[model samples]
Target: MSSTPTTFDVRADFPILSQTVHGTPLVYLDSGATSQKPQVVLDAEVDFLTRANSAVHRGAHTLAGEATELFEDARATVSGFLGARPEQLVWTSGATFALNLVAYAIGNATAGRGPSRFALAPGDEIVVTETEHHANLIPWQELAARTGAVLRSIPVRDDGTLDTDAAASLIGERTRVVAFTHVSNVLGIVNPVAELVALARTAGALTVLDACQSAPHLPFDFDALGVDLAAFSGHKMLGPYGVGGLLGRSDVLDDLPPFLTGGSMVTTVTLDEAHFLAAPQKFEAGTQPVSQAIGLAAAARYLEGLGMDAVHDRERTLERRMMAGLREIEGVRILGDASGVERVGIASFDVEGVHAHDVGQFLDDRGVAVRVGHHCAKPLHARFGLTASVRASTSVFTTDDEIDVFLDALAGVRPFFGVGA
Candidate 1:
């Protein structure tokens, strides 16, 4: 065996990458939306379902015991992936639910259910960024409305970077919560997480990080990042869909009430009163996604084998190549910090005159896959003075040839649409 760490092959492990689209070989570039699953991840779920299928943490049978062990082991693997403890991770449907879980739980606490640590009253402020995905934005928007707190935002600079000076001004003593994305799905730019976390800490405010984009592309250490809470999706990281994680400081979790309450999340219940379980269990109610959790654990193990530093280096190289090629194309304007700002392997952009949907369709016709439109980030789009844009994001499996094909297809979009030279 070679002493060097094994580098993953972009083409061999993923079966879907072998197929064709419209009689041409497929070049999948839309991993920002959802990544294609590897054979191992698929096999893990199938293996669990075929042998140990049962309700977890609520049954006494042999299958149940096996399922429970797998489920808890997944929790441990995922926690290790994010530099968190197993007990600090809460299972949710996806990042959307994880974020909403935080918002609603804070709202629950505000409604006089728990300690004031998670509560928000009138005149308190919630700060987010102008570049946040709707998943990160709308929850805090509703939270402000629910708690009579004010909603403020950090401004986006011309290059799609956050204005830290503006953030310093916006996040003051009255700021109850400072929620921001670790990376912009649209801009592909990494935010200043440590700086923001420090500011929030100084203000005595809670910090919520949207880590959906970062966890897959970067080396993440949630505890070291020093945020009060964070959320990420499993599917985006090459795991099974319908499973994600919400990680929080134990004290914060203990302070907030449960967002969804029912079976398996409580200690005792009477007709008029109910006692809930501890931090994670209190947050996870009803039947959980057992097979998906097992598959996510498999994905975590796979990523660990690859080593996150190696993964980040590979994706960043591909991203730089992608940006350079896109910049060479006439009338193709890469959005957000195109001057090689620190970013992941994501690139969203607008053509000179053609609409983004048309560009996406043209790319699709050429056997290239990419995401189009606002990407659930309307405010960021409006800031760029457009309603939509084309996005091509990369994964560890993306290749040099694939990126070259995408660039060739993109170069033809404007001319095909009869746009300016």
Candidate 2:
């Protein structure tokens, strides 16, 4: 594969893109939903299962030792990818579970199980943005309900960008926690993390970032971003399902109480009382996702080899091409404003006189797969006066030719439905 900034020849690494659908070459534009795994990631899981298939940190046998080493090594690799320490990252089922873990841990704190700084009192505010995915929004809603905290949101502008002035006003002395997404799944626009973090800091609020979209496409560093906590999913980053990570500062994790408690996380146990382990282990109870973590580490290595800067550049080129093409088509209303803002290679649009499902099916018939729905973000869609829209997202394996094919298939949607341009 070439190493140029504007070109990516890494499509061959993903075997799923080679097959035909409906007698046409498959053109997958739904990486924002979930990315296709490469051959190396698949091989990593199979190799670990075949060779070191023992429960980690359990028995003193050779297989157990090997399994434990491999598992911890996987943690180190993923932590390096995020520019975080291994001790600061905790494994969970996915981003949903990670966010819930933080919320529930804070709830525990409120119940007098941990530090008072994390505890919420009556009239305390939990702030979120209008563009948040439900994963980032609902947990806070539940947390606020459990505690006496109030829930508030910063509104989005008509162009789908966040209203930063409103955010500055909302994140004042009453704010306890501020959760937002690093990138919008619906609009693909990158949020202003530095500005938001500064606001939260000035107000003495905890900043929680949803990095599920940025981790796969950009050069991510949790330490550099200065967020108190962040969550990301492996499946969205060319790894397997059933695994994700929650990253936090060492002090923050040390202060958080355990969300899930059981075996593998206890230091000492009596008939009536038990002492828990440290963070990362305290949060990870029962059995862990072993082979899936190995596969995710392999996926991280693959991205590192390709260089994240080059990947971002190539995707930006594709995004510009996609936005330009969509703008030229009549009756295609894009969801967000693409003028003078940083974004990823994702475009959601609505076709005139046709349902989003029909548009998706039309593209699917031409072997172009896209996501069509509210995309688990009903609030963002409702903000735009839409219940659903068609979304096309790119990945490291996406090609210029594939983008062209997707744009051409989209241009034919209105014509096929007999809607006049």
lDDT top scorer? 2
Candidate 2 stretches with Cα past 4 Å from truth are 1-5
Q: On residues 10-99, what C-alpha lDDT tens digit does candidate 2 reach at each position? A: 878899999999999999999999999999999999999999999987999999999999999999999999889999899988899999
**Cα lDDT for residue 53, candidate 2:** 94
The CA lDDT of each predicted structure is: 0.92, 0.94
Model 2: lDDT to the true structure: 0.94
- Per-model tally of clashing residue pairs: 0, 0
**What TM-score number comes out for model 1?**
0.97
Best by TM-score: 2
Candidate 1 clash pair list: none
Root-mean-square deviation of candidate 1: 2.1
